[model samples]
Target: MVATFGEVVYESSRAFADDEEEECEAQTGLSFEVEHTSVAKSLLEKGSPAAGLVFCAFVGKVAVGFGDGFVNNKSGFDLLAEVCMVGQGENVVDIYLNRPKKKVVAQLYYGAKDKNNPVIFALFNTHGVPRFLANEIVSKVTEFIEVSNRILIFHSDTLAYYQSDERCEGKVFYVASSKYSRANIPSTAVPLAPPNVIGGIGAGVLMHGEMMDKPALLLANYGENELVDSISLQPFAAIVKQGAPDPSSFSLSQIFKQLELTISQSLKSNVNPVAISNLYI
Candidate 1:
């Protein structure tokens, strides 16, 4: 039951002028392997939600996310929190389930926006999932739901290249896996520096997409501290809202307010439902 993880001790984002691969330097990282032959079996057997692609987000500061509270409820099995510290040992985690309740193992949610809506099919990561389990959690979770060739990953982290503006006010940048993905990137985002690198779970997803020839976009919103509010989070909402079936129907502020509340509850109330998702629990 032991696991390996790439605990990222030191992460630096290098700057680049053109569209080159990111240059990452991590003092320590988490790495692990698991047997997941039946990982996606539930989604395959039970069916998955409808969506063009997954709009997954990784916000470093928001420990509590919209994905919280979706439990596995396996009778004797202990329910997991979305946020928890993981060491190199046998650990039980959640991943998939019925559509109305599946968000993820740490936070698998279903029936989210169950009504016939624009179909965001969103996935939220509290932050630094890899620090506890490296990208193993992400890699395993990807086995759950299926998506099209295109994937969009939104995350907040420190970008040394943008140290001038700072992570809180730092500009948004994007790194695409292929030329096609780059063309799809919105004009509002800047390109990460040539020598800079994008790390964490998003890095693994993007690289895998590149090798598979799948078009994927990794949008970075630089930030200095753990997320507390939705100050500079608008760009993520903007990109997502812009892609909705009816852009106007999607209220940017509403999502922000939700984000604000989630952060508020985590800080003020000291309750991170994210911890229940197990790995982080």
Candidate 2:
């Protein structure tokens, strides 16, 4: 699936500070302050793992542009679209509906705990589904499955490019299978170190299990000159472990304080900065 994302990178602890900073700037209208903060004492410290974990939730509407739908293995036809949002918040929502003209979709939430959980989110087709009926399906999914906070757009991008429907294709179907792969890691297994995929920290997290057999550290997983979008990545474990100057002396509360302030301030000024999910996925 094709997914595009945007994010505002900021010091989570200074969210509110960023807000004040913006207000101060707007009031003064001074372009004097450097666009980027480089002071080590300030919360804008880069590459800090503890600084990265606070992804909060903000509500917004998604516009589903008209597009082709995908064919499914089931008796009925289905549509799929690829969408994603990489914001510095705990919750994100996906809005979907049969009729794009009439905005219809659901909200999904994510938090620090699931930082490393590979499953992004899941949703079912609810096109033509009544409001009450649609809600019931959503409720069931939330109750039974994790990542309920994530919004799932039914008939999304995956359906948009189905080759068979217009091509007189036959239906695709799913059958029960007792076969299992021995390589499958149990859900409880600790995630292996992240792989060094260029421009793919998120994807690396998503595919952690499969790539565990490989080295977890970027120095080992990636070659010297991999071309990733301007991310200055070091080894994953090293980064996480080296959160603060003194590895032995670290606190979650301190990190939270820094993140919360950063988000409020930066976002209040319409900056909408993105914070790294401190998740160790």
Candidate 3:
């Protein structure tokens, strides 16, 4: 049978958890496949695509993934987690990045471009995990997020970010958020926060991380909002300082400018009507 492109990428990431067939399937399920395919397709014009790959720890989220939130005030960090051709990168997947066969959703080489100066971040919403996988919805809280070094950085409310805990999902360490007022964030921007359960994917990832004794961080927006500014990327600034080889070399502003340009173009392409009333954002 000819495996679909989505299946190929899913399988690639799936390879990270080669043993636990049942548990793995239960966690990822068809839902993950659907989103996986949807995301892969979004990057393709029509056929198979895969340039190179290195299966590092995967950075993922269910719906409210970082692919959305942190609007307006942007992060000038010029380093963008540019998506790559990983859907059908057979040679890359089988050789370069996976020769050791480490179990992970995959991660960036951090400074692959210029290891000496290491500026660009090699990951983010890599067009495989859907922004809103069905199983991660509020109605599907029972299911746990799959195993792997999957970091959960989705959107959240200012309340949750400041509170340092999720109401339904249990106690969680609040990481960070975009700076914004209570009112809803901009359209292109996203109002972060798991739609439910302290964050559906967020909770699951935390649980899985605990089991591995390596809890992934939940870097999220300070509030459920979006934007057209550079402040949105402030939270990641902390990460840059921590993980980047040469922290000072980066600037959230550059990232904000790049995203701002791309997003502006995207916005112009769509037809969005203005809201007549603003009672509760």
Candidate 4:
């Protein structure tokens, strides 16, 4: 039947065994029937309309799915996970620094970029985008950037250089900042001036540029270094150079496809959908 977020959580909680009961109760405020099972069942069967009202929120688009978290584990079934996408804040910057597909080892070909070099790339997909897409795009972009640069250096932080012309010598540091986007980074001045650690939304976008105010940096929220580590993995570096054109030109769908592949690969070789669903239940 239908269920509100709270009611859904409450029913899910009641379904758990004894030891787990208190934990869910404490966390979700879902307790056993002080009244009766039938009363709770009735409420769960007819959930509030408020749950349906909780759309995507930001873009105001109605969220996909019926507020239920279930998937068939098939081709298009991945879209069902959208329930977890709810209520995410912009505080976390999801970076996809992709490297090129079919990369050569330590050699920069004319058009073949280094798949390892950090570069922002976008992949297009016909389906809507998801978190998993980031992995593929990151791989492709990395390859393209490596081919373009002669001295390839990578660090978790920024680097600098001094430029001496006939007139004078000026120090230029590749400063990283969360304030800039790929579109606007071209206009940014070199030797990024102080106090800002390159990490965040703009930092991921900046990686695509020839010379960044700082090396590609991603400003992440505190206690989330795992996000940084996750992007560093191999699959995330496999960049998708080009994909089918998108109306918005974002190619987010391609990125999502790659991400899904990478994630599916990570979950054990054999995963039973029914068993997995049972775990969630």
Candidate 5:
């Protein structure tokens, strides 16, 4: 079934009691239900289109799954949970069991270079799970950008930098609002003059110099921090230095393969599966 933007859905918990077989069956058999919350709906309705749409599920205070995209749908939740389960360190039980108030399970951000650009999504974690999965995504995206013919760093709120490489003359190009100035560039990094033209979109885009085909990478950052965290950037740099997949096409399966994520169990399961590809947005 489909869901509107900001709608919340619930699935039966896998946890069950030893002596309550019938009760467990009843709980497991229950259909997913929408949770009605005025505040959540309001926030979603008012959220910026640039920020994309977010759908999240919580068991008490712990977020079990979350997804983000330009549009909202039920399948995104399943995708979120599938991605959440990909890595080691923290299992599902540990995530749900040790619920702390206001703790986030995962945060997914979807950004597009323009109406025509392919949508790109990034997932962030609050606790428990190691950052290997996030790192893998960053690595793949970084490789794409490095090999592309032209690189543009898109930003809405403030100026951000993409690490320079041989393809771009080891120089940084700016893509920010007209108000952007040299003062906005942080002191820790070498300051380059802002680009003459403000980027039309929020996510960074890489294009072939002659052919304006599909972008090599589309990137967006969401958080309180003014800059994209080093945790996400470091791995991307490491992978690019080691060399990465050629920038011919982008595929979710290829990324999963690169990360060594097993999909058989995820595919077979009804509750949590890789449903990101099915998303309309």
Candidate 6:
């Protein structure tokens, strides 16, 4: 039988667990419960010829574009696509009906809590999703999930940073001065890092050497007067620092290794799992 809109799917967070033991425990990370129930069907059935899907998992938001149609065997990528399209936009909806045989591109954002259990606003764009949809997904995500006062969305070529104010109902304002680059970085280089404030220190894949010659793991701040410090990196600084083996070279393995170390450190430090979910995987 085909699944319909508003049907809750119980997913095993075990697939996202750290080890065999954790997987065995089968912890429930985030429930794929349907939201925006009022317009799910119509949105799927008639919104647009081009379908865009959005969904949340443990506070993480993901969006994908697929061809319109009724979906069958909604497992793996298909299920993921459907979840992302729900309540995504007025132009796109009803991703499940007549689902496409394949997905176009999927954009993901990782959400996390700091040491104090406050939400961390961070978006990671693995796939090249459009800026408009990315913004829309993040906005809707904040509405459904508890979020921090600040927000940052990172893509290969662009970075969107925002600060929220309680006085303004947690509305976010974009930071136009933040700079980022992916030029000359290998497509294999995965950009993953804990989200830091717009003008603060953080670590991730940054351009090193002259003319953006190579992709090197570096520690740097986003804005002027911001120190390149490890205060934001905390427990993972020592290990991640090792990944940058001088500015003259780039190693895909080393980069991934550093990411793994960061994730392990995060788990050990009791960092919110949701925050580190997309960092390594």
Using lDDT as the measure, the top candidate is: 1
Stretches > 4 Å off in candidate 5: 1-128, 131-137, 145-147, 155-281
Comparing candidate 5 with candidate 6, which one achieves the higher TM-score? Answer: 6
lDDT of 4 at 189: 18
Candidate 6 lDDT over residue span 1-281, tens digit each: 11112111222110111232232234322222222333333222222211112112211112111322214322222333232321233322221111112222222221112122111222222122222233433444333332211213222211221111111111132111112211211222233342232111122122111113332222222221111112223322232212222212323345345544654665587653223312212
lDDT of 5 by residue, 163-261 (tens): 112122222223212222222321221222443322111122222211222222212222111122222222222232333322223223343233223
Ranked by lDDT, the better of candidates 1 and 6 is 1
In candidate 3, position 100 carries an lDDT of: 21
> In model 6, what is the error at residue 1, expressed in angstroms?
55
lDDT of each model, Cα atoms only? 0.29, 0.23, 0.25, 0.21, 0.24, 0.25
The lDDT, on a scale of 0 to 1, for candidate 2 is 0.23
Worst 10 residues of 5 by lDDT: 53-62
Which candidate comes out best when scored by TM-score?
1
Q: What is the TM-score of each candidate against the true structure?
A: 0.31, 0.19, 0.25, 0.19, 0.19, 0.22
lDDT of 4 at 16: 13
lDDT of 4 by residue, 1-281 (tens): 22211111112211112443242232321111111133222211222111110000000001111112323321111121121221112211122212222211111111013222212221111112222322233233332222221211122211100011121111111222222222222222122233122222111212222233433222221111111123212222333122112222323334435534544554565521111221110
Q: In model 4, what is the error at residue 109, expressed in angstroms?
A: 18
Between candidates 1 and 2, name the one with more favorable lDDT.
1
Q: Which 10 consecutive residues of model 4 have the lowest summed lDDT?
A: 52-61
What's the residue-level lDDT of 51 in candidate 6? 12
